[model samples]
Target chain A: MADSIEKVSIVISKGSLEGVYPGLIMGNGARMEGIEANLFFTFFGLDVIRKNRIDKIKVGTVGNPGMHMPTWIGAIPGMSWLATKMMSRQMDKIDIPPVREFIEMIGDSGGKLYACQATVDMYGLSMDDFVPQVEKVLTVGEFYELSAGGEIIFT
Target chain B: MTTVTLAGTPVEVDDEGFLQKPEQWTREMGEEMARSAGIEKLTERHWQVIDFMRKTYLDTGAAPSMRALGKTSGVAIKELYELFPKGPAKLAAKIGGIPKPRGCV
Candidate 1:
């Protein structure tokens, strides 16, 4: 309680729609609080900011016990689409935006978005593959340095 | 239920201090809740935000979250805290006599 939260830096490793939304929502929520917000996307998490995939991310029903069904049932064809549709419908009732629109909202509201250079290299993806919201690609060391003095959350 | 007299009339509140009924909410009750939340005075800006929250909740049947409040109420989040103290969204919802907004904790 001695130190007030001046900033929040979130790192995302998973790429599913459920995994990606927490970072986006929390980062956007912090920005709403007038705090500095930063999101670092790595590995599969890069899909969240990818130009081609950001709008197309889906729920990973496999092994997700929250689906309330067996793993094999979740793995059935069209189940992921069904899950995604259900999630989108549920979120709509709360006025929550879709992924693409949510990303745009954050960028327009001054939330910082970054991509991991190592992951970009590993996936052989260039800046063009990322959404225009990505400010830059930062190395792990640079992220660590910039994220200093802020609360770091791994999602 | 907890009862607190507002404008000389007793009103019931839930365990979390939110009003038990939306129809029981009034400007005086909001001011009382603001006072309890550590705001000594309800300024023009505070009323603006509170009125917007109340209107939105009435129309939508849901309390406005922080994001919705900030975007539509012409009030900044930091200023909301300054007006409502400890927790702005829940405090505003409580004052507005709306249910607590889920997914915003």
Candidate 2:
């Protein structure tokens, strides 16, 4: 246990459902292990904490090799929606809560949720646009200060 | 695995101190384990969670996930953390003499 992580800072930089879930899962897992966890949402990742679009995140079917389909087929009008629905069903079967519930669970377990100030400003978003679980908007310097002594994971 | 005495009864536990043979667990052992985990005292609410965990494990052959515990244990998530510090699902399972839950959630 000597090498066990005492804290973790995870950076989420994408808006796609697959992109956001890794950071969310990791942050929640760290809290479950009694480790302090912080999730920093930057760039498109802000969608995860945004009240208006949290549920609109869809699986990135186009250009995502993980989808295992041809790029042309992925470009079809409904492919992304179909892919997202299939993924959600699979996740639901495994008892994984939807994104909003997962975020609330992490926050309730003492994991801190943060939004990047620069991204919020660039996207014309304000504190009011985010979910109540978002603890704060942080500059990069403040994020580094908060993440001191912890591993920083960029997803 | 190792055999350790808890509440005057010897029981087998794994490396991280979870019970290796859950069937050998008793209520007195659970209280002793909880006390050692800095709980000091297991209140009625505490037993509610531990009992639910044991029952679930007995029924499902695995410890309940955190999501399941919160939804069905009748304990609010915030209170679950308060009742068992750190991680309620893992800690409560440990105190209840069950293996640590393997779920990712």
Candidate 3:
């Protein structure tokens, strides 16, 4: 018998470099443990699952309290770009896949990806807008129902 | 704990003969373990894999998967098998003194 988690539901609500990685990495970890993993994407997190756009994700430095650098320096227009590049380079050195490949790997491991219906409507995106790995677009109520009796994590 | 002699001294190991306390593993211990696995002597190529697995485990709390090691450690799977013939991930991690890799069954 396969030792596996019964269920895990992870919420991805932000699209920034820091925000998107947690869900994807944790989802991959869950799938490795033979868990039934469901990743729910909403708001800007929708862009993470959107086809051809996942690789274009950038660092979200605006109003970030952990920016470490001085506020004025972080306010510099190109800082986010530099930070995103550095983050991507670091991830590459560690052999972490880019967002698109990472998401596909999660699917390959039997994890399910779900998009938020409200966000899909707000952005005027259809099923075609998302990568084929996305299993469904669910509402808040549907998500709660589907995730019932499972662990819910908002990242 | 099981014991494997290294340089005439018995070193404690787990049932599989991997060191029970990885931190106490010495170069002689690694070589002793390697020899038992059919690796006669450590080579630059062999060290490439052993060192990579060791360094990666020390740097990160987790050891790299065999897939990740193949991609980033600059060691081919076939060659890794050639260097550590007993079993690649399990044996190399044993010699390298890291915990048994999570994916190794």
Candidate 4:
């Protein structure tokens, strides 16, 4: 039965810039293990599946509990921007790959990325707004159908 | 249990673990992990980012964000996008072998 678990599916519901990495990592990791992996990008998660906006996704710092209050307070009106910068800098100092790169890597590695049809309609986004590699825009039920019989991880 | 030292701290390793010492995370090890992740080769730029990530982990005990990573590593945001098309948060964490960071889910 363990060997029969040949595929893995993940659902990414969070849309925040900071919230997108987990799905990316897990999906990519599964693919590295030679497992068939699918990622269902819904709601805010659609931002990554969106072509133009995917690269522009920004970190959320306002009211974020993890933000350093003193540094955030010092930035004042530009705290969000500053926090984003600081976070990126810290990541660079450590050698972690950035979000956009991870997505490309995953796609290049043969992992499938999909957008939610309902969210596209609700957010007024169109097919042109998404990257070329996205397989399709699907509904929750459709995504569930794709994810059935495999591990469905909602990140 | 076997113990290995990391930055002067002793970390216990399971009996069958591959990393019996902190230094076991060698360039070869990193290269293999990168290859497994579908990165065929490691350029100086890749090593630069990876070394920085490791150092940052030693210093702060957490994964840094892309913006912060850029500032400290002198890698421009745009270039970062070029280097890590998937977004720095995920790729960096993956290469660093760290658990997914908070808020990334």
TM per prediction: 0.68, 0.98, 0.64, 0.57
Per-model TM-score (chain A alone): 0.96, 0.97, 0.91, 0.85
Ranking by TM-score: 2, 1, 3, 4
Candidate 3 lDDT at A118 equals 98
- Give the poorly placed runs of model 1, Cα more than 4 Å off: A1-3, B1-51, B57-63, B66-105
Query: Over the full model, what C-alpha lDDT does candidate 1 score relative to the true structure?
Result: 0.81
User: A1-155 in candidate 1: lDDT tens per residue?
Assistant: 25467788999888999988888888877765457889999999999999999878899899998778999999999999999999988986776778887887677657789999999999998989999999999999999898999999999
Residue A18 of model 1 has an lDDT of 92
lDDT of 3: 0.79
Flag clash pairs in model 1.
none
Please provide, for model 2 over A1-155, each residue's C-alpha lDDT reduced to its tens digit, 9 standing for 90 to 100.
Answer: 35678999999999999999999999988888888999999999999999988989999999999989999999999999999999999998887888999999998888999999999889898889999999999999999999999999999
Query: TM-score, B chain, candidate 2?
Result: 0.96
- lDDT at B51 for candidate 2? 94
RMSD of each predicted structure: 5.5, 1.0, 8.4, 9.3
**Weakest lDDT window of 10 consecutive positions for candidate 4 chain B:** B15-24
Which one is best on TM-score? 2
lDDT, residue A99, model 1: 89
| Model 2, runs deviating above 4 Å | none
